[model samples]
Target: MCQTLRQKHNLTVRRQDVMLMMADLDPVGIEQRSRRRFVRRVYHSLGPNHVWHVDGYDKLKPYGLAISGCIDGYSRKVMWLVCGASNNDPDIIAHHYLQCASEFGVIPKLLRTDCGTENGTMAAIHCSLRSTHTDDLAGASSHMYGSSVTNQRIESWWSYFRKQNVLQKDLDECKEIWNTHTIRAVNQSRCPSGKPDAMYALPHRFNGRECGFCISQENLNEFFVELTRSTCGDGQLQAHFEELHAQSNLTTSYTWEAGVENYITLKNMAHI
Candidate 1:
């Protein structure tokens, strides 16, 4: 509310002031929970792209849909969020991640995720990339870290997502909205562009580091092809994966015309 007032309305009200107004609007709902909870602890990261918290939200698993996303540790900006029927598939997860990296033009220095198979393919590539840096100055560390509670940055956003999206919504539309949504800076300082798009592109506004590092197209293609073979057959799925890589622009949409229905049906049945 404070961010909206500052960015959209050009008002100068403080966040505490907005909270007071909201409490007055709903006195009962504004009361704090009486239940005991863990003491709030804060974690810090060096800057944007230094660490990313990635996880899958499976509340829509029964409906053959799930969401996977990454959020920057320092800026609290979402790197990318993808909703799909094949969210459980390692290759699909890896593809969405690579596509995000391609669009942003750099993969993060570290990726933090729970120990899930969905992250297996991407984790392997991150490991291989780090291994290439035998020299002391390479400074390539493990891309993935395993701790769900430690990933509260992105985890906290899920609660609000659940509240706002009470019904089924368009996946692409949800992605667009999340990407453009404005957020308050860590210090609650007003940023000219509070939206994630601006925060990520202009991290300097928050005195954060700029995104640095670009992955080559060839390496991306190799990783996907290798991951595809490990997860599925060398037939239709492989062809579709290659076609995605061949596109001049990585954002081009491609559907698994051959096997998506069956895959989704089987996945949904497993949950049932």
Candidate 2:
């Protein structure tokens, strides 16, 4: 049916497009029911601050290393990536989150991870959340607010990234070099379309100016704080934190001790 439609309309009918067309063609009552279900599922998946998706990939190698990565949904940024010999634990995953939090001065409200042994373990998830200062604050804010998980977005990104960077069949040949180069390249590259809405507008409406590559960390923090306070509340600078806190699952004033510790450590190292 999709092939026929594509031929008739001179359109490339992808799976999702075909699904949408089918839903539209369904009986009115059925369409409504399906739409409701879809909406419910989507709403349930997004938390307020940021939703992170983590996954591990087995490298093609005699080296036998595994690579893990976490991506932020809103900014479409690669938060963290680590390569290690063992894929049996969540230490790398937790460390990745810590790195992201320190870099951005914000914590993810919900984390979406695959149902693998390393990711799905109760101990891993608990430790991942409990060990971080940002997580503690995120938990408190969530308790005073609300939060959710959306795994579909991260899964979609994974598919796209694999297709673009790692879909080669000859994984054993140039895999190590390719993996390292590709990961680094992807991180440094800017999205061709530019940032969503371009937080800063052009000086003149008609005149074309190239958008800047990055915003300073201080400015970014200020922008985020203002956005959070305006959108959520003065008390909680993160919407997801507030959402989860409202649900009584998180606290409101947890310490960011880990963040502080890392910052001090980095400063000292820089001095040396």
Candidate 3:
């Protein structure tokens, strides 16, 4: 509420003020929200990059597109948001993981995800990458699989993403938005309150340490070679959109409405 006021109205209102207004303007909502019960779950994280929750948002899948993303558990920063042909494809998912990790030159100490077949390749890749890391969660146990409901960070993101009716179709543009969204601080909780990017970049400011481990390009290359060798005989999903994108003469970003239009344009071109 405070953030909304500040951003939309350029007014920095107090939390108490917002509460009072919400009570008067939306009594039923406030009452219902107050009565909501939260199930107890004991979850802890060291800091940013300590654990990344990876998941797919399937609500838009019926439109012949898919959205998959990963969020840092501690800082609540979205590490990656990818819009593509199929979030279920292992190679595409793995590519998003590797590309995002490459941007930071490091991977999370641990990765939390739901037990989905689509996550198989990403799971194997994370474990393989963590082979030489000395963390407590390294090696075979580096990836933790759980139910979607319990994969809190990314799941929570999907909820908010839907609530906002995020119509921006450019994955990177959408990524920039929620990545900077402010998370309200809970009273008596140790979680920091601020924009995710700030907390992720400067964890020490919030009394947290950077928990990601640096990885070498050679390791990534070796794994890619193995991935290629293993899929040699199988039908592979090439990055056709990328090939089309280069020749499409389109800007790299688009609103959700614009993206749909541009997607059709590229799809037809690819078919041709």
lDDT of each residue in 151-200, candidate 3, tens digit only = 88788778767744334354555566667767777653466878899999
TM-score of 3: 0.76
Q: Which numbered prediction scores highest in lDDT against the true structure?
A: 3
Model 3 score (lDDT): 0.77
Off by over 4 Å in 2: 1-48, 59-65, 120-150, 164-272
Name the weakest run of 10 consecutive residues (lDDT summed) in model 3.
Answer: 229-238
RMSD of each: 8.8, 21.1, 5.4
Q: Per-residue CA lDDT of candidate 2, range 114-143, in tens?
A: 556565432333333434344333432321
Model 3 per-residue lDDT at 42: 47
The reply for model 3, stretches above 4 Å from the true place, is 1-26, 165-171, 187-189, 224-253, 257-272
Q: Kindly report the root-mean-square deviation of model 2 from the true structure over all alpha carbons.
A: 21.1
TM-score-superior candidate, 2 or 3: 3
CA lDDT of each prediction against the hidden true structure = 0.63, 0.41, 0.77
Each model's TM-score, in the order given? 0.66, 0.36, 0.76
Compose the digit string of candidate 1's lDDT tens values, residues 1-272.
56546654678897788988988897766665333244656465656676678888888776545678777766666677666555677887788777777777677767778888878887777656556555332343656566766667778767656654422244444444655766644332222336766666778776677544567777676676434333333366546555544642334223433235544444454453
Question: What residue pairs are clashing in model 1?
Answer: 111-143
Find the candidate with the highest TM-score and give its number.
Answer: 3
